[model samples]
Target: MVSSIAQFQIKPIGAELHLFGIDISFNNSALFMIIATILVSAFLTQSVKSSYTIPNRIQSLAEMTYEFTTKIVSENVGIEGMAYFPLIFSLFMFILAGNLLGILPYAYTFTSQIIVTFAISIAIFLGITVIAIIKHGTKFFRFFLPSGTPVYMAPLLIPIEILSYLSRPISLSVRLFANMVAGHTMMKVFGGFVISLGAAGFVPLLFLVALTAFEVLVAVLQAYVFTIITCIYLSDALYLH
Candidate 1:
């Protein structure tokens, strides 16, 4: 019987490549990330191959995805945020692909790992902050300090706001990581039950099926939540409100 947590272990596929102290060898996590990226790229490519006045199924899906991301950015960040539509959309689709693909049997779920999600979160946070800095210059500091604040309240509120802003990536990354890990780990446990219980495992087998479907919904929803929060953060940066 395999341990439920065993599935989360990272195993290298081939030669362990350690260049300059960095373990850059290809592993299950890397393989799945590659697969997710390729899948998203291929899907979008095929989805938009034919552009017609009347929408085909593939075109419709592609168009829907485009409009969905556009709406997310437009609504949250307004017109100026449209400049980042492609960025926000790519992030959404990438995470969405990772979440969905990980649901497959025997597939590696990198998003379950905090490192992967944290890296993405950090990148997004940095990019948004950089944009704010570039666009607003010194006024970017005003983000943590609201205008018309009493001198007494400035010190108290400023530190709290700063901490909250700094914790954005941590909170954002952990939410996805925790969700994926919890859901996948539960499924693994149920799967183990089905295998070990023999004929009597039918109950758990049924549960496993339902859990798998629920994970699919979670996969999409997590992607949406992350993207929306990012949009909100971007909007705050742009508008400083």
Candidate 2:
């Protein structure tokens, strides 16, 4: 049987200067993130530089991405949430590229790693917390209090709210990490069956092909879900609730 758990092999590319007692070893995940960043930057710059009034292919792609993200933010958070377009759009592109790139044979899947997803989720958590505090000031604490709750229940409800708020990062990170890892593992398992069964494996092989297509759709959909959730969080922060 094929192993569903991927090996977390830590290959040391190089070690940076140690900070205090901590040594930082760069690895494949770092490399893929750098590549993803460069790809996103290049694509955006090229698309914008070749701008056309009537919209060419690259321009249309860029516009479509913008409109897609704008619609999500607008519908979920309303017009006042438009200020978050850049962050939402960047998140969507980076994640979409990372997920899609990982679909390629032998490419590293960064999103499958907990560290990467945790970093992203934590950043979103912090950004929302800061925005809430800044926009609502000390009144942000009121997010915990239910509108119709009895004044006596405030003590009980506030802690629950605090717990829920604190759990956002955990929930966000796990959702993406679990989905990416599970789908890829399933794909790998089915793919192995095709190889092992040889010519007689045509049925399983056909199913594997279909699953590949589904995984591709999932890659895009998960990216969208992550981005839209981010917008919703931002909206909650900005509008308080």
- Model 1's lDDT to the true fold? 0.93
After TM-score superposition, the amount by which residue 228's alpha carbon in candidate 1 deviates from its true location, in angstroms, is: 0.8
lDDT of each structure? 0.93, 0.84
lDDT of 2 by residue, 98-213 (tens): 88878887677889898889999999999889989999998898888967889998988889999998999999888888888988888888777877899888888889889888
Question: How far is each candidate from the true structure, as Cα RMSD in Å?
Answer: 1.4, 2.1
Clashes of 1: 0
Q: Each model's TM-score? A: 0.95, 0.90
| Predicted candidate 1 versus true structure: per-residue lDDT over 1-241, tens digit per residue | 8889898999999998999999899999999999999988887887777556787887788789889999899999899999888899999998999999899988998899999999999998999899899989999999898888898999899999999999999999999999999999899899999999999999999999899999999999999999999999999889887
Q: Model 2 — TM-score against the truth?
A: 0.90
What local lDDT does model 1 show for residue 146?
Answer: 84
Identify the candidate with maximal TM-score.
Answer: 1
